[model samples]
Target chain A: MMRRIQSKALLASFSLAAVAGSVIAAAIIYAPEIKPVERPLPTSFDPGEVAKGAQLASIGDCIVCHTADGGRPFAGARALPTPFGTLYSDNITPDEKTGIGNWSFAAFRRAMVNGVARDGSHLYPALPYEHFTHVDDADLRAIYAFLMTRQPVEQVQPKNDLLPGLGFRPLLAGWKLLFLHEGPSTRDPARSAEWNRGKYLVEGLGHCGGCHTPRNILGGEERSSDLSGGIAEGWIAPALDKSNPSADRWDEASLFDYLTTGIAGGHSAAGGPMGPVAEGLSTVNDADVQAIAVYIASRMKPESALQKAASTVATLPRDVASQDPASSKSTIAHPATDTLFAGACGGCHMPGAPMQVTGRPPLSAVSDLRMTNPRNAIQAVLQGVAPPSGRGPAMPGFADILTDQQIADLLGYARAHFTDASPWPDLTAEVSAIRKEDAR
Target chain B: MTVSLIVNGQRRTVSATPDTPLLYVLRDDLELNAAKYGCGLGQCGACTVHLDGKAVFSCLTPIGATQERQVTTLEGLGTQAQPGILQQAFIDEQAAQCGYCIAGMIMRAQSLLDRNPAPSDAEIRRHMQPNLCRCGTHHRIIRAIKRASAVLGSQNGKGDAS
Candidate 1:
């Protein structure tokens, strides 16, 4: 009986030891290192340093993400939609209660470099700390100085509505271990100073890859498809690499022009999310813009002839069909489309028409015609482009002006007459849906 | 603070902060309406002008940075009565749409022509790429530049032959 009792006691102790071991393992896996941050008493900074900080902020494009439309700058509350869910941006203003006004330099550094909150909770990589981790100490200090100098705004940001699985902060500790590469990057010795500067801005602070690079199932950027292309804010961020779809090669000059001016002559226009990025980049130094162009050009190899042909649609000038000797034979094949185009669009779109020479983008070379998807084209037709601010001659929306059947017919004609592209899928349903949604 | 500038062949002085963009000084102080303010940042070449004969965004260039440099705007190119060769070519080709981006386009084109008196169609397109024409006058713009290049070429040839 005594021996039996001893055996039971031993079993009990063994079970206790197992439970304790499991607890310890769980703690190690979940808990991040929580260090106390020390901050000096607040003091005014040098004006020059503060000015430099402001410039750096512009380069980083802090205002675009932080400020919601029609909201105070840097007061935050911008809803960033993601595949996961909508996450709200935080107020970075110097409000002690609502913003980062009370955050010490050490606390700010920890958050920027380590992606940790003041309470030692893991921050979502959505903040882009993965890239900002490479930001040098001097820039970080300057940013901190700039934020500290700003007027303290009293506003609280809405909580992030992350997808259910992402709500658990401890899971992010494992994510950090898997993905985050903390510290400054090692520069390649073979590269020029300009190339390195471009790399720094594009990879480190600009975080172009964050949006441009495709992501995996877990939301980390897919390493194999770097800058090949990705989707952001419901628009496709086209491949910046050799896979860029422009018929002509993007030389350094063209790339520089595109970045600096938001347009590359006949190539493409900056719209959607990229529009703001282009505007922000315009504030940076000319040399830096050049450097970025140099870096991007270096990545893109000259495309193959087959690839170029596949990419470029034969956007013949308007006079081509009307004047071409071979057009009579081709016109016989699709007389209905020809008639539809002439009636619907020929008024202003034909060669030498006043609107064609004046306000209208040539039907032949417009970026929308070349896109693989018909979304931009359909949207432009249904809801006409408002000429940019102070750049007047706004095109009227065709939602009320044209019937769905007529739009589809016109689109079909545009594809046949203006471009060599395979006709985009019938867009009648899409036009109808968009019009209904707009009405609502 | 007062900043002295050489604007469109005229020496002018304006009171503004040293860091103020030259585009603003030209617009607000000198009242030169040709150089537009499309994007306060230089993303739109509407604010492009020649600084020391090189095309630069006036919106991005600070007033302090332009000391002792010649700044040329579209107004300097020529007025409505007597347009320069490039300006006249643009008019002949109807190369402008809204005309907001025209000043910068002309300036960029001038810089290209100055460097390369006879640029190929491809070279002209590449050089002129920096100036955006949102209305898509690019094809016509190319033609105008080529037309101007031919005219300039003939003029040069005649001078040399004589």
Candidate 2:
């Protein structure tokens, strides 16, 4: 009789442990649904707060990913390609049927901080909550107000095309558990107030590290090597630091020019995904932009380079071309490449080209030409630098006309002429690889 | 500084800054009046010419880069008395307004015809996109290219689906 009693007790204990385990698993993977409120009246939000939210949203670059090409702003359908699969953006417009119109401030905050939706499902980390979590409640509130007042557009976002098994939202809970560090980043007291603000904005809304920092196997930014250089939208977001491969060091003024105008002469132009960021920052307040430059320039070098202002004009290559008695001294006896370069790129790139006279930086001064990896330069050749807005056309892409081998030869010739850096090894293979990647 | 280039199948050398744009070389030094100077920024194709048998903006190509390359201007295409097939087609179609962009339009069209003997309407438009005709004579230019293509295709006895 005593043995039977002990066995029954053991069974009861096992059942209890199983119940506890189930509850813990549920808590980790599940979030309680926030009650949806009625769409608030636009007038309910203060005008000043709305305007501030507008500025913050610009810095956040919400529209860049949120809006589909040729679609209404904030009426999301932008396809963001990931290693997992493609994920469409959510509509942030005030449409009650399709967007965040009924979302309470609490729901919005939860989504931004925890990558959770109003309906309690886990959102993909592609939303960049890792950075948004650094944003304070007050700023988030302002952004909420701004979004709440937007013109409603009744557009349903397309379903995410995640890999099989990965489509299950519950799996994201584990990812968040491992990577998400919810709360504000600590302010550095040793830094100036402007610098602190810059840090806050950059780490929070700018999310510079999302692109500038390397990612691990799970696609989480490697926090240990923040802003050291990473790939974004298939283009290299070069290290904004001493490790930056550009010929010239970035000063605050140059950084400001680059961040605001999308191009800083003698340094680099903001191309690919970075173009929109500059376009967005151009609308921001000058003082705030200046603070960002000050902080980023300091973060970039942390040395005397920051103190010295970079020259706004690019002149070195032009000077060299004027002084160069013989450009035929290229060590490579490549006549085909020489003719191709003369016809294709010589118009803008040759030393005496009018582009040089207009202060367009010569290829030699560009970091792409000097980088150990030639992908960026190859991309530049293939795609060209597209302008940020509808203002003007940019460098014409040559992918349609120039063959991969011809491009390789041209670049080989350019490297020999423009930079002392070692010629890009197996250039045709690299160009072909990049083309395939871009196509994918 | 002196630079040498083959112009219209003739080897020509001129004394100028090696960095001087080919547009200035062809115009100022060689006295070839075919390629014009419009937007020196390469946006406008007014200074289009064939370098090494490819259409390039002479305004942007430095003389130094043109060494050992065949530079052909509209003047090289044909004289006023006898015009090239493409030029004849343009004249027949009257594909010019102010005539500023005509020389560039001809050179650009010649490159297309050389590669794609018979091109579709879309292909012609896409190829001619880089060069701008401010006079709104694109339809005429398109017609001329098509006319030239048909003639060349018949002459070669090779048919292309266009």
Top lDDT prediction, candidate number: 2
For all the candidates, what are their Cα RMSDs to the real structure? 21.1, 7.7
Per-candidate local distance difference test: 0.71, 0.82
In candidate 1 the C-alpha lDDT for residue A376 amounts to: 59
Candidate 1 wrong stretches, greater than 4 Å: A1-43, A302-363, A376-412, A415-418, A425-440, B1-162
Measured on C-alpha atoms, candidate 2 has an lDDT of 0.82
User: Model 2 chain A, poorest ten-residue lDDT window?
Assistant: A317-326
Q: First chain TM-score in every candidate? A: 0.76, 0.91
Q: What is the TM-score of each predicted model, taking all chains together?
A: 0.59, 0.74
Question: Which candidate comes out best when scored by DockQ?
Answer: 2
Q: What are the per-residue Cα lDDT tens digits for candidate 1 across B30-66?
A: 9998888775434467888888787877765666556
Instruction: Name the 10 consecutive residues with the lowest summed lDDT in model 2 chain B.
Output: B59-68
Count steric clashes of candidate 1.
0
